[model samples]
Target: MRLKKRISPHSLRHSYATHCIEAGVNLADLQHFLGHQSILTTTRYTHLTQSNTDSAIVRINALMDSIHVDWGNVK
Candidate 1:
């Protein structure tokens, strides 16, 4: 199968990093995977878009549910 359009290696790297962040991967681990010398550099490269926020919310909700905790009642 052929891609609809060509993607450069840098684009692929960016996508990988974004997906990893969305999947709740730790920033330090992601930095290691990307071979980034500084966490600040990794932060600049990864954009935490709305989808990433939504994914984080979902993960948090799942964790709360697993623990049988009421999210709204948190102090």
Candidate 2:
């Protein structure tokens, strides 16, 4: 049997980590699941969390609102 695409064990591990982070799994629990000696290793998935993206969007919108720029006035 042959495969068209190459898939590595690490790819599955990475996917698990990403999904767990996005699903709001506890950091400590994730750390245990991944068998990492340090929590820092699991922290890499923090950037993939939906909450982080949502919070960033909220902050950007708030900043834009605070600026109150008038696009119509610009020539």
Candidate 3:
């Protein structure tokens, strides 16, 4: 798996963080996952796109629905 293109550790870390954000992972959890003392640092690593944001919102809504809690009303 050798190629002319070289990938840096920062690139991998940034990609992982971005994917996690796209997967609807909580930012605070991501911060801890990345071992960043400051959440701002974690934010620096993650790049958010509109599509990823929409998907994350959908996933979060689905999760909330699954928990039977919507606006403090239990279903």
Candidate 4:
């Protein structure tokens, strides 16, 4: 009787690592949590996290609004 499925455990572990990265957890912390021998292994999960594009856009907009530059007369 086969009690376990044929799915590979590596895939599940990859999913878990990716989820942790996306949740704002640091790579070092995740590395420890995943029991990886090297931090480089944990870094592979960084690609799963957002590229901070939203945060960068928000900051850029805020800066544009806050700046008081007079572009009309200034050369």
lDDT of 3 by residue, 1-75 (tens): 678877899889998998898787999999999999999999998776898878789989999778876699888
- Per-residue lDDT of model 4, residues 1-75, tens digit only: 875766668768877877776566788889999888999988875563345567567789998788675866432
Colliding pairs, model 2: none
By lDDT rank, best first, the candidates go 3, 1, 2, 4
Instruction: List lDDT for all candidates, in order.
Output: 0.86, 0.79, 0.89, 0.74
Count of clashes, each model: 0, 0, 0, 0
What candidate 3 gets wrong by more than 4 Å, as runs, is 1-5, 53-75
List residue ranges in candidate 4 displaced over 4 A: 1-6, 49-75
lDDT of 1 at 34: 90
Scored by lDDT, model 3 comes in at 0.89
Model 4 weakest lDDT span, ten residues long: 46-55
Q: What shift in Å separates residue 67 of candidate 2 from its native position after superposition?
A: 19
Question: Stretches of candidate 2 above 4 Å error?
Answer: 1-5, 49-52, 55-75
- Relative to the true structure, candidate 2 reaches a TM of 0.56
Tell me the alpha-carbon RMSD of every candidate: 5.0, 6.9, 6.1, 5.9
Better candidate number, 2 or 4, judged by TM-score? 2
Which stretches of model 1 miss by more than 4 angstroms?
Answer: 1-6, 55-75
Model 2 poorest ten-residue lDDT run: 66-75
Q: For residue 36, give model 2's deviation from the true position in Å.
A: 0.9
Ranking by TM-score: 3, 1, 2, 4
lDDT of 2 by residue, 3-74 (tens): 887789976788788778767789999999989999999887455456768967998999777765477562
